[model samples]
Target: MRRSAVLGGRYVLRSLIGQGGTAEVYCACDRVLEREVAVKLLRQASVEERDRARFADEARLLGRLSHPGLVTVLDAATSDEEPYLVMELVHGPSLADCCRGVALATTRVAAIGAQLAEALRYAHDNGIVHRDVKPANVLLAEDDRALLTDFGIARLLSASTGHTATGTAVGTAAYIAPEQVRGEPVSPATDVYSLGLVLLEALTGERAYDGSPAEAALARLTTPPPMPSTLPAGWRDLLLAMTALDPADRPTTVEAVDSLRRLAAETEPAKPGFTGRTDVGESPATRSTAGSLPGSAVVTAAAGQLRTTGLGAVSRPAGLARRAGLAWRWATAAVLALVLVLGVTLWSNTLSGRPPQRDTPAGVPDRVQKPLQDLHDAVEGDR
Candidate 1:
């Protein structure tokens, strides 16, 4: 109802598909290229130079990033009152939609993580940090290929990426890194943390941390989530390393790619012509859901529009902000818990007139901490 047509002869608009704060995406057919495409139009009134500059900058940035998992930017133009971008139209469901009460098979989730990590690595090498890397930003193709979308909130590695005019936090709250929440300059690690969260959600069907907005912000900044071992062993180390509270402690993109590959290999069989589906027949509850398909639905031909499902539907801006705040609070609580445990241990030792044990002799290891030492050596060696 906002506007009828857009971009004139460049692309024929079919219908509005989505609307955001400053943009509206439409399903359109590219006349020149003769292909179905998604056209995103900037909705902000261009009364200020900064808005125009940022809009143009995003288009330019997207044009530079070329990857199979990333959404392809085909054309950019300004029409009537807004800027427009024509991009590849993809069909499938978002990770959020599929993330409701449903837990994806471990292999499928790892496959998605691997694809997205590769995309992030490519972007980082190109000096682009996808500030926003959440479920909604990821498109699961009909064939289950992971495709990243919505680079609108992406930050260039150089210069002041983007910020609220009134000095408020930008970027998606739940997915935003601690540095971003603290108004610090964002780095590739910021995206790494976000991607880690995505992997966690895909595996556990639960966010790492959740609470009100202030609490969530504090949580991400102060506390690290429990180890992935709390969920499953295959991906525990990988997720733990990726979500390390200290950016320096997180694994590099290459490491992430390797880890995810291992996880995928363990869960999914390696066959010459496997398309990520085994074609197992439906069980008893195939038609339980009125408007859904059976569990045994195989991945054959590409599906249609990405249906809204599960966590993806929880993307309300206000709720997102509140959730982020809540996560910060949970993080704070985690910090307090760690401190209390340390305090209790120290107090108990003090009462018993015993001092905390120091490291064993440099070359000779103590038998008590031998296993601990070995673990330390393995982790350090891996690094």
Candidate 2:
């Protein structure tokens, strides 16, 4: 656990990051690649043939999965009777760290949920199941993207590790799926259910199912998750679908991911639209070509608003269509302004108090009178 141990003849251990029931994760230096890496070593006391195979299986599965949202496995081997996995060292706080007491921002929670769902989908597509999905398994980097980690309990669909029995529970109590608790076979749906509970905890900053481990695991057999009020639109429904008792009632991990991504977009902060507003540190060319997406769903709304001066509230994307849209708004403004000015002039002329000038009557030119009638009709039509 100290900072000087080396592993696999290359990774020099720096410090212990954290530990789980099966493994201890350490921050290490990959002297071969000159980069910092994470090393997961099975605790000496828990080391066994079955445990070692499961640990190695996780590394092999992760080695096959290449995703930006997933923590990359660099190597796995038995070093001095202890099996270890070298992985990409992520520098960030875990989701659990962020959700210490108060609920995180809905946008952040939704975004994390979306990404972890994506990672799960990737694993599922490759015949692996992350049996555990909770706040502790998700890391939040400075980039704000969620990184999924710790597949220590993942089961490969095709290979029989023979570690878990058919009827034995295998996940954390608070976030365990009902089927998992009953010792039923697991699928992607199991991860979905667990992720739903994790999302609920993230949103509420409290475990929806709380009690002793036994009580929590057994409660889901009959008690449904209590529906909450005042959530973002469609969020409650999504969670309900995810945590449904029957696998058929739950959304697939892919579907859950899509819903979560949409929810994230909906709850994101209001981003400035592509009008022409200058952003700090953004070059004019950059602003025109690459409109800043504040990662929100409000771009279209912001784009729809053009000020009276024909300038947009934010720099718009560079394209003929954007120019055309702006041009259309200007044209509309010009037409409205002309109509307004003409109407005001006509109204003032009609007022008897200002009737010093000769009124256009019987002797007036046909052009003037015709235009007047046309304008009056146009104004009336508008009303």
Candidate 3:
């Protein structure tokens, strides 16, 4: 698509932001709304009837669903020669980019997992199964909020679109669940399995199943995903259960959400000064700086920034730091006051012509007594 091409008579395409297997996403300006939005157009090469139906299905599914963790579909036109979808423009990188080759903090992983699980639960509750739940489909917003996007392969539980037939597996190879590979039916558990893989990758900084699509799919059927010994017991157990071979054994999205939230909370005490926000920016160069400072320092610095920006709550650590600083000042003042009082008392005795009291034994050896008395006299004279 050329720059400046108007779509649906209102969206002015500016530049290409992303290109997937079947669509090309562009940064566009909505002339009617006067705001920037992302426009996803079906690639010319993938303008077949099946692909068109899938694109229309995604638009309808997103329009019906509403959640903070799911990308919102603003508008769509699938019948025109240049079919396109308008969506909220997320200003950050994908989860795959954020955790490319390095494991994120445990707390950060759990928090992000919880957010995705909640989104999945919402979709499941509405009878939709997001067949594609890989890291690439998950976008991290500027504020570190994880939003699930790209429902082009999502299946409606109550109805069949006829595009995806039985025995035809349709998802990314690395993140597909075992059952999905068998060409069997899918449910919420399928999404949970994919999410488990995503979380495992985030924690280990490597794909659980690697190789070509055929090799990865076959490997999952025979070998279990390897879990690292360094992971916390809760994380290990949760991941193990979520990726169970039997879908029946896996926890529901609701259960997964609760477990993940608990896991996230468990890491909070260790981060006493953190505001629980992981600022994984749009690029690797702008990754979170929270790891560079102590937990308390991170809290203090974030609090200051929040105060200056007039955004978000600046309590807790900030308040604690202020109170501690005030107490330190008060303690120092009290010590100084006590020293001043003692000095004043000594000076007053000297000014009033009253000799300062001295502790001297009634009988002392002359040798020791002489030196002691001489030192005392010297001190008094100097005063």
The most accurate candidate by TM-score is: 3
RMSD to the true structure for each prediction, in A, is: 18.5, 28.1, 29.4
TM-score of each: 0.66, 0.67, 0.69
Ten contiguous residues with the weakest lDDT in model 3:
288-297
The 10-residue segment of model 2 with minimum total lDDT is 287-296
Off by over 4 Å in 2: 1-4, 268-383
Angstrom error of the Cα, residue 181, model 1: value is 1.4
Report lDDT (CA) for all predictions. 0.58, 0.61, 0.67
Compared with the true structure, what per-residue lDDT tens digits does model 1 show for residues 154-223? Answer: 6778766353321223465456666665445777888888899777766655555544334455555544
- Best model per lDDT: 3
For residues 20-98, what per-residue lDDT tens digits would candidate 3 score against the true structure? 6567788899999899998888778547777788889989999999999998889999898888889999889888777
TM-score of 3: 0.69
Q: Clashing residue pairs, candidate 3?
A: none
lDDT of 1 at 279: 24
The superposed Cα distance between candidate 3 and the true structure at residue 55, in angstroms, equals 0.6
Preferred candidate (lDDT higher): 1 or 2:
2
Better of 1 and 3 by TM-score: 3
